[model samples]
Target: MVDPDDVQFIDEMPHTATGKIQKTALRDMFADYAFPA
Candidate 1:
């Protein structure tokens, strides 16, 4: 199982024009994301 602290929730997910997940965008958006203690 994945550690709870390693999880995150968001109101929306970044996507491409074609509706495919934009990994690059996600990375940039969460570039400063920090996991919980």
Candidate 2:
């Protein structure tokens, strides 16, 4: 199970003009996420 506090919620997934999921953008958004020690 994951901790609720550590989860990041987004209004929607970022997409490209062609309607593809923007994986790079998604990764960058959570790049600063910190895990429990």
Candidate 3:
């Protein structure tokens, strides 16, 4: 599970070509995501 306080936010549920969670995209999208300290 991801923290809600992260800098970058994607509320949409990840999905792949076969309706699977696209972790690659999600990782890429939030690669630089940083939470306030």
Candidate 4:
């Protein structure tokens, strides 16, 4: 389960050649992300 307030929206997602989510790219993208207190 996840919380809506803690979600981040983006226009696109990074994926790998195997058609899997690329966490490395996500990390780079959300490097400065802040979570709700």
Best by TM-score: 2
Candidate 3: worst 10 consecutive residues by lDDT?
2-11
* TM-score, cand. 1: 0.63
Q: Give the per-residue lDDT of model 1 (tens digit) for 1-37.
A: 8656576678899888899998898899889997766
Give lDDT tens digits, candidate 4, residues 1-37.
9658777789988989999999999999989988879
Winner on lDDT between 1 and 3 is 1
Q: State the lDDT of candidate 2 residue by residue for 1-37, as single tens digits.
A: 9646666679999999999999999999988888777
Writing each residue's lDDT as its tens digit, candidate 3 over 1-37 gives: 9756645546797897799998898888877866679
Residue pair clashes in candidate 4: none
In model 3, state the lDDT of residue 30: 73
Candidate 3 runs further than 4 Å off? 1-11
Minimum summed lDDT over a 10-residue window in model 2 is located at 1-10
Query: Against the true structure, what is each candidate's TM-score?
Result: 0.63, 0.66, 0.56, 0.64
Number of clashes recorded per candidate:
0, 0, 0, 0
User: lDDT value for candidate 2?
Assistant: 0.89
The reply for model 2, stretches above 4 Å from the true place, is 1-7
* lDDT of candidate model 4 versus the reference: 0.88
| Candidate order (lDDT) | 2, 4, 1, 3
- Residue 37 lDDT in model 4? 94
State, as a TM-score between 0 and 1, how close model 4 is to the true structure: 0.64
Residue 28, model 1: Cα distance from true site in angstroms: 0.8
Ranking by TM-score: 2, 4, 1, 3
